[model samples]
Target: MQGRLPNGTLIAVKKLSSKSCQGNKEFINEIGIITCLQHPNLVKLYGCCVDKNQLLLVYEYMENNCLADALFGRSSLKLDWQTRRKICLGIAKGLAFLHEDSAVKIIHRDIKGTNVL
Candidate 1:
């Protein structure tokens, strides 16, 4: 969901899918790990909500959306060689930070354009 903070910062809120097999356990684990991660290349987790039956994770809004949309979606944004290289480098940096630089090692099982932004 798209929302704005009181200070007017745009954000993307990800709510836990009720149909997900892993419930609160996975949510807590992700919040615990992601909260400790700090990197320029990574998406910033602003906060979360676990009130009553709601479980939502808040993230800084990405202006360009995801790589899949940029490359294939109806959006007319062109991906030149330089832009593609920059995106690739950014992804590499983010992955490197998660795998080797972060406090805990994280092996991301899903790595795809849809997941990249």
Candidate 2:
């Protein structure tokens, strides 16, 4: 879901579903991992919430959405070859950082169209 901060910043809120396989431990791990990484290609993690039963992760909103939207015609904007190439390059750069450049060597277990933004 999309929401506005007290400071008027538009943010994306990821509320972990009750039926989701991921638990509180994994959520905390994600917060820890994302907080340590910084890259233009990677989505920014602004903050997170763990209040009683709710597990919400706040992220920087990307207006363009994700690659799945473009591929499956869910997006309004038509992507050109240049745009597609850039998307590929951006994903590659992000992976490179996670795989090599970062102090902690972390592998992204899930990499898919919907996961990329």
Candidate 3:
């Protein structure tokens, strides 16, 4: 779900299923990592809300949605070669930074189209 903060910042809210322990771990790990890291291409995680059973991850909303949507959506606007190249470059740079620049070496196991938002 998408929402706007009091300061008018758009955010995407990802709700985690209470029954999934793996989902819970991913949610916690994402929040912990994102709260400390800052980069231009990476999605900015604002904050998270953990109630009695529900967990919601609040992130800065990307105006264009995920890269998968831009590439494969029903939108008439098709991504050109140049735009695709730029997107790949951005993803590479972000990954490289996460691997080499951060204090902790991180590996994103779920590197798929849907996750590349």
Candidate 4:
């Protein structure tokens, strides 16, 4: 979900999907790992919370939404080759950071269209 802070900072709220059965410990660990990394191509995790036993992640909002939406949505907008190349490069850089450059190496459990923005 997209929302604004009291100070008017735009943000994206990610509520852990019920479909995901990750325990609280794992969730907290993931949050910690994410908070330790910073990259231009990676989404910035602003904060996290366990409110009423529900996990929530606050992140910097992307104005254009996810890559999957741009590729498959009903919108008629078309991306030129240059734009597509940039997106691919960005994804590569982000993945490289997670896999090699970060303090701790990470093996992304899932790589799907909707997961990339």
TM-score of each: 0.87, 0.87, 0.84, 0.86
Stretches of model 3 off by over 4 angstroms after superposition: 22-30
Which residue runs of candidate 4 sit more than 4 Å off their true CA positions? none
Q: What are the lDDT scores of the predictions, listed in order?
A: 0.86, 0.88, 0.80, 0.84
Least lDDT summed over 10 consecutive residues: which range in candidate 3?
A: 68-77
Q: Compose the digit string of candidate 1's lDDT tens values, residues 1-117.
A: 899999999999988766666667667788888888889888899878876567899998988778898889646688999999998999999999999999899988899988888
Clashing residue pairs in all predictions, respectively, total: 0, 0, 0, 0
Instruction: Predict model 1's lDDT versus the native.
Output: 0.86
Runs off by more than 4 Å, candidate 1: 51-53
TM-score-wise, the better of 2 and 3 is 2
RMSD to the hidden true structure, all candidates: 1.8, 1.8, 2.4, 1.8
- Tens-place lDDT digits, model 3, residues 10-115: 8899997888666656677767977888888788888898877898889889766677777787455478899889889999988987889877777766776777
Count of clashes in candidate 4:
0
Worst 10 residues of 4 by lDDT: 69-78
User: After superposition, which runs of candidate 2 have C-alpha atoms over 4 Å from their true positions?
Assistant: 19-26
